[model samples]
Target: MSQNERFDNNDSDSLILSFNGDANHEFQEINENLGIVRDVIRNLVPLGAIKVAEGIVIEPVVDYVFESCKRNPNMVFVTLYYARGLQEIDHHEGDSVGPALRDMRKKRIECSELLARELVHKFNDQDLLFTKVLTKRYAFSQYDEISNRKNALDLATRLYSEMGNCGAIFLSDNEVQACVYALWSGHLVPRISRTFPILAVIDYYIPNHNLNFLENFKNLELLNIPRNQYLLDVFSYIMFLIIYTMVAANYNEIRELNGFLEGSMYLLVFSFILNDIRTLQKHGIKEFLYFRRILSLILHVILATDFALRIKHVTSFDHSIPQFHRKALSLVPIFLYWRVLLTLEAFQPIGRWLTQISRILKKSMSYYILLALAFIAFFQSFLVLENTHKRHEGDDDHLGDKNEWGIFALLVKGILNAPDFPGASKLENRFGFVLYSVYVFTVSVILFAVLLPLFMTAFATRRSVPEEYLAHFAHIVIRKVKHNQPTRYNYPSPFNLLYFTLVLPISSLSIIIGHNHIRLYANIEKFLTRIIFFIPMIGFALIETHFVNDKQDKEARDLDLRELPGLPFPEDEKQMLRRILYGLNDIKEQHRSLHFRLEAIESQLA
Candidate 1:
């Protein structure tokens, strides 16, 4: 056989073994070797073991196993095992040297295995391939030990240069998982999910389709119990509504309800401000820029101003100025409207519809502007003609005055085609009647004719906005409101204000300082700090477990049964199976082509 034929046969044999051979046996062998390595390391002291392993048994055996695994790219389990063993040894030594060396070795193994797999699998999925490459680059930039920081710096520099030429990788599900795991392991810095492309994609694609009203009701019921900052806000808003309703119904008995309403309003404003501050802290200034948030903030200011005005009026200090009270009363409707708008966000469908309407209006803005200008010009022309004709046919008969059209009345009459419209039988002059007819046609009929099509086109071309973007906002709000935190800190307005302002800041600072100088603190102090933080976390977790009910997992399982590429299919093996079918199709096509060529050759020979 030719050399190429032999090579092709060997490739086919390897492909067969990869799919049908017992992966379990290879896994068991790798596990056994890992056990031996661990046992040998456990027998020696940290210092002596490092020196002896360098000169004798440990280094050579690990190198040999790693090198042999190179021939079989599918044996990544072996590399993973070796890395785990080395990490254990590094932990045992309580020194940076072992981990530094291990990290370097792991980097090499990861790169080699990744490249080999890419060549062997030859996956058609660009997304998957890009993610693998990104993960490899990220892994190289992260070292397992502080001593290897310089190596990390060098890797980062090289990776940055390569990235510039290759372009940024599109984040797939696998890349998201890798990046998240790396972050959890302290290889990557803590960042907002929006900072990472994969995480952002996940946030955008994962639909929050399920809404548990029972859970929401339970949360609402427990609003006053003081569980967290979010609940406090809800509680305050509810109380404000109740008080405002009572005050509105009992305005005549204002003196009696003043104290209660004022107090509730104060609490409401404080809670709103606190929530806004928390949002600012979490998402930075961008949160305040959102339309809903901006409107809410404006309402807060208006309400606070109103409250101050009411106080002044009650104290008899500003009794002379009834205008202040009127101003405050005028703002009440606006505040109520703002609150109603906020509630729209809780129901996604309504919010989506509103979003679509807003989009259509934005697209049709120019048409509306043109219509407005036409109306203005026509109204002005009619007003000028009415004044001129009235003066021309002076008040001698007093007939012009009786038939006169006021500016406001003329504009309304003209638009609505009322009986008093100038071109209607009311106008006597031929020129004036012709002018009025032209104005009505231009402003009403023609302008609307142009506008109707634009409106129709705008509505017809409306696209379904991705629910993911909308869901992300809702998720943030939901997370905040349903956040599990210590009950003690979730006090009502005044107390919450104190806790958040004073206690929370001090506690946060101490935690940060304690973490940095952990050894300086005694075990008891460390344990106490951990318990304090863990209490809120555990409570939140339990609440989520009972209420959230693993919706994400359920969605993933449903997707899998439907053969959809859901979140859990990041490591899917189905793609590999498809490769075999693709190969068969290619072979069939090649055979048919060769047969056609053979037929042509035989006919020519004949």
Candidate 2:
């Protein structure tokens, strides 16, 4: 690619990974470098071997002899020449040689493969050959340190030379290199999955800022994203839908998995949405909203297609091996549905949108269409079963026969896929309007109820809670009150409508008690269902009411405390003291009563 077309390293940064095309040339150069490396290694090995042996054994022997003969004049000369040569090589070759080799590579100096093999052998040997070179070069009585460092440097240079990049290895020392194998050997699958989105975002969308939607995609690059984050999100919506549909199918397995899957997926969805909001904070709100909307649209399309296929696959005319799955395989689509729903819910607006009917007629239309499809499937199944029994001439022989239902399916399928004809076209026209009306009504209701409320709540909170107010609120609720716990919902403000929704049950307890009664339940199923449905609602309501009420009274309580304490004393204001003391006593009594009631209710609930 041309320079302009090449990946941008700024603004719209691109990961432009290019490989060296001149592989033969690069290999030849590396081999040549290795030849020179071998010559250096061959010289160094003997020196290293001698030094290691000397450092281990000879040093002590020399010291013992020297200390016993300290007055001897010859010992001084023996030490002098040894010290000088050691210092010379330590300064010249040991310190500067590695850098000089690197510089030679930069200068494109060619070496031979023979030299590479020689160096590799010497370093690998780690015997007297390696130690002697170090002892001769350093002239140090102790050659262990010199031999170790030289061998390490050789191995490092060889690896880097072969790799071409050597970026990571060259920066660290030999000890670091040994520890790095653990990281290198680890599975890259998870990392690859996580990075895939980032690469896709940059490749497909980053360049077209006018398509500016790509800014939203940048949030995926967060390093601390939860494990199997994408898969978890997918699981959330899928599990939810699976349980929902399987409940209709009367599958016991569905119910069992539902609770575990639902709870985890819910948390996953919340985390996903929370992350989205966190991401939005980096970008402007408008862009954030746009990015979220686009993502939602994409998710919705995928979910819709999945659901459509599931219906078609399950309600097929003939069982030429179930297209989707043979057994609990249908649960896959169900799980997928749950994942999509939960993920969408992670973005509060999207979740709410799925539940709500934008227009009254739209939901009615969906119900009608659903009813029609169900009727057709049911009738088709019935006919196929009947026909199969008739062909077998005995219901007893064809227990699995379902051919009677095929006729109905064939009819329905024919009409659905019918070609436009003079008479058939007229029939289609009559039904088409009704179908369109239903679609419009359903879509409108969904938008109005589900999508609108969610967006409104989110936007309202964002607008109402200015940063200054948020800071002040945080100071009061978080710092001063020491209620450092985050709310169930990470609302922009405490004054959000969501708080109202949470508190609704607590505020209006009579509404729940009036219609719902445990006394009439005939089975645990109904009782558990009712309780499960209301538990979170009731619990959240209690929390919201308790907090919100306390929040409201806090200011007045502070004002009273601040002003009451400063009032004139009994000597100057007898009447004031009487009123203030009596009031304080009354307040203490009231507080005690409230605390008693709270404790009693908690005990009962428990």
For each candidate, what TM-score against the reference?
0.42, 0.17
Candidate 2 lDDT by residue in tens digits, 407-451: 443344433544222322222244423443343354345435544
User: Mind sharing the TM-score for model 2?
Assistant: 0.17
The candidate that achieves the highest lDDT relative to the unseen native structure: 1
In TM-score terms, candidate 1 sits at: 0.42
Q: lDDT of candidate 1?
A: 0.45
lDDT of 2 at 606: 100
Candidate with best TM-score = 1
For all candidates, the clash counts are: 0, 67
